[model samples]
Target: MDGRLRVVIAEDAAIMREGLTQTLTRRGLDVVAAVADAQALRLAVEEHRPDVAIIDVRMPPSHTDEGMRAAREIHRDLPGVAVLVFSQYIETRSATELFAEQAGGVGYLLKDRVADVGEFVEAVSRVARGGTVLDPEVVRHLLGAARRADALSTLTPREREVLALIAQGHSNAAIAELLTITPGVVEKHVAAIFAKLGLAPSTGVNRRVVAALRYLGS
Candidate 1:
């Protein structure tokens, strides 16, 4: 067994499945299995137990959310394996549901992101290592569709901006630099954001992920 990251591709489209298998293989990752439907994807993951499974949100028969359902099942039954779900169109509800249930070793991205091979591979690697990744567009939708409008309305404009960056998986220092403010200021804003949203104050990546999930009203 090679030490490279093992991956399983579960895309219904033949072209996409082959393209991803070849792309990941060329990038030095092991493509243990590539399947076209949700059932095959589940079998591949159970058999190979790859480090990560890349799945399409829609697949087979109804083409509704077979892949997403399979992903949820895998995440529940095999906590060690990561799942990265991508969709051709943005589905805010699906993204919210996924992150709400599985905080670590999960990601939701748009299919268009595959066009940038480098970023796509990085996202896959990040998820495989138990890190969370959310597409910027998905973050926007989550922020906009937040259910707690009254609570969200209480945030200052700056606080709201900081929350948006947080939901995009940015660190405090990164948010500070992007907003051209000191880290201290970013910290204050983060605390305030959590307070206004009725979340417990904490630190680190997991805390930020929880804050992001809370921001999505999950």
Candidate 2:
């Protein structure tokens, strides 16, 4: 928390870019650059040499896995830079693509997390510090893949409560409010869920959404 981390943010949406930048800045992290497209993201990373890159999982010109590809390149060219990916949905291929590069120093979280600036910033810091952070939603999707065997078995009752909230796309604060628990307690539950599912925190949320649909579809 003492040493500020340099960060580059890339999102195709303008409002999201601005909001994220302002939020990160308010949290005392240095947003070295903010861009709207994949090309701009590449250039921004090259120019800024940020310690971390907080990127949306999709961007133009194709708006399909562009951010994941850019992240791959950054992981290759800028090994020191971590990436935290945000997404509205989770698809299996997307998750495979992002982590296919390098799992370390990466994060995948749902866009809903943005509502809780405190938790979002904490996730950013975790990735910057070369630790993984995955949205518990992603973990539920992964665990759900286990079929009727009760995908929920991997967690304690408390963690199951957290995962159920996550599957509903609830924010940590929202989950805390619903359960009459503290956000910190929710975080512990989330951590437990992630460990049981073998999901790194940085697994992109969109990918998890895809996984969830697939798991739940059956």
Candidate 3:
């Protein structure tokens, strides 16, 4: 988690895959393998055992959800390998599926976000270190869908912002800094969130990931 991360890229498009490899390489990450289709992605991950894998949501041979499926398998089989699902659409269903079983070391980001090289790179590193990373757009879509849920409706405006940041995989300190509030206040808000959502307190679980999963309706 401290040094350079090894990565595997899975995308159907050659241009985008190569470009991403070049970008990640330039950013100091070692691209162990870059492959097309979900099958190859799985094979590459198995062979390289990279720290993280960058996967496109759609891939070859009935491309509807091949990448998402592969991501789920990779996460299930190799718990240590982080997965970042890259896609052009929000695809709330796929997003929900990715976080269904686990939340840490996983991310869902839109392809358009790649334009912001720094943020994209940060997302990769975040997941590589067992942190969640949900794109703002993906978060918005999930939150929008959950608007009818009674618990979500009860959230105050400030609480809603804090929850959104938590869904973005931000730590208490990071959320506090981003929202320009004290860390103690962030902790209070998180406690309130858990209480309001009725999510039982558990020592082993990552609270941030739990909040994100709730937001995603997983």
Q: Which candidate has the highest lDDT of all? A: 3
The Cα local distance difference test for each model comes to 0.87, 0.76, 0.88
Return the top candidate by TM-score: 1
Clashing residue pairs in candidate 1 (N, C-alpha, C atoms within 3 angstroms): none
Residue range 78-118, candidate 3, lDDT tens digits: 99999999989676766776787789999999987667899
- How do the predictions measure up, each by TM-score? 0.66, 0.62, 0.65
Predicted candidate 1 versus true structure: per-residue lDDT over 25-120, tens digit per residue? 998899999999999999999999999999998999789889988988998889999999977866666667777887999998888765688888
Worst 10 residues of 3 by lDDT: 143-152
Those runs of model 2 whose alpha carbons end farther than 4 Å from true positions after fitting are 142-218
Q: How big is the positional error of residue 27 in model 1, measured in Å on the Cα after superposition?
A: 0.0
Tens digit per residue, CA lDDT, model 2, 97-177? 566667788888889755778988999999998988888887676555444224446567777666666777778899999
lDDT of 2: 0.76
After superposing candidate 1, which stretches have Cα over 4 Å from the reference?
148-218
lDDT of 2 at 150: 48
